[model samples]
Target: MASFGIIGSKGRMGQALASAVEEAGHTLAGGVDAGELPGPLALQADVLIDFSAPAALEANLKVARVAGVPILIGTTGLDDTNFAAIKDAAKAIPVLQTGNTSLGVTLLSALVKQAAERLGDDWDIEVLEMHHRHKVDAPSGTAKLLGEAAARGRGVYLEEKMESGRHGQTGARKSGDIGFATLRGGSVAGDHSVIFAGEQERLTLSHSAENRTIFARGAVRGAEWLIGKPQGRYTMEDVLDL
Candidate 1:
């Protein structure tokens, strides 16, 4: 069994990851959070799974690099700096960063891409996502993941063609642009829908996360898959190929 170390041990996802490791018959090397350093845990683990805050990402990658172990990053709302660090660290050890870890979401992204490719741009694409009230980021990472998939299918970049958080005076929806709408409330795990609206018809691809276990389970499986890989970056898409 592989030894797994968690970087954000106090958070909900962290606790879930710990349980997932146990359920998957893997050893929990240990965990650290906030002020605690990840060095010791990194040393003990065969692989590291980071669900920590964006600010802690660099330090976590550092420890994993020094420990010579692969790392699976499940953190959300990362910035460009965090991504650059991940790229640099990945040169020394395997790294997997994903917006959403649920296998169903991953597959849904693929289907969205396929649908976007087959449909004409005359169909407006709008992404909708809802999460728990406590979630800090808007539009949710999974929404962006699905939007990016649509962008890829259309041979365009998400940031360039995306519009979100519409308020007053938004006028008309651009033809080639993808839109995003976010909702927050209650204890909903996650709900994501990608809509392709045409003149007379509409197609929607969606996924509902009933519980956090699905993500934790998929993350545990991803951590297992990252071990023994050559130094590089990976994603949930790679998990799909497996």
Candidate 2:
């Protein structure tokens, strides 16, 4: 069994991941929070799993790189700067990152891609997501991931086609534009829906996460899979073989 090290040890997702690691019969190398240094845990673990804040990404990557260990990044709300750091670190060690690490979400992305490819632009695509009230980011990272899948199916870039938060007097919805809506409230674990709206018919694909354990289990599975993998960037799709 692999030894797992956790970042953000005190947070909700971090605690869930710790439990998952134990349930999977793996060793808990140790954990580090925002104010803690990751060097000690990084040195002891076979692989590192990060569910910390975006602000802590660079420091965590440094520890993983120095320790020569593979890492699975589950932190959301990351910006381009964080992604650049991850890409750099992947050159020296295996790195798997995802917005949502649930097996259901991984499969759902594949289904969304197929649906987007089969449906013509006449079918307007819209993505909607809702998370816990404490979530800091808008549109949620999973929404962006689903949008990327849709864009890939359509042979377009998400940046060009994504339309988020329409306001008053916003002109009619543009053809082929992928829209996004977000809601934040209560203790929602996570919820996502992709709608293909076409004349006289509509198709909606959705997944609702009842709790964080699904993601925690997926993260542990990913960390285990990353062991012995070649240095490169990967995703939940690779971990789940989707």
For model 1 the local lDDT of residue 139 reads: 75
Against the reference, the lDDT scores of all candidates come to 0.93, 0.94
Error of 1 at 177 (Å): 0.8
Give the range of the ten consecutive residues with the poorest summed lDDT in model 2.
Answer: 233-242
Model 2: how far residue 17 lies from native, Å: 0.7
Any idea how many clashes model 1 has?
Answer: 0
Candidate 2 lDDT over residue span 1-242, tens digit each:
98999999899999999899999999999899988899999989999999999999999999999999999998889999999999999999999999889989999999999999999989999999999999999888899999999999999999999999699999999999999999999999999999999999999999999999999998888888999999999998998787
TM-score of each: 0.98, 0.98
Worst 10 residues of 1 by lDDT: 233-242
Which numbered prediction scores highest in lDDT against the true structure?
A: 2
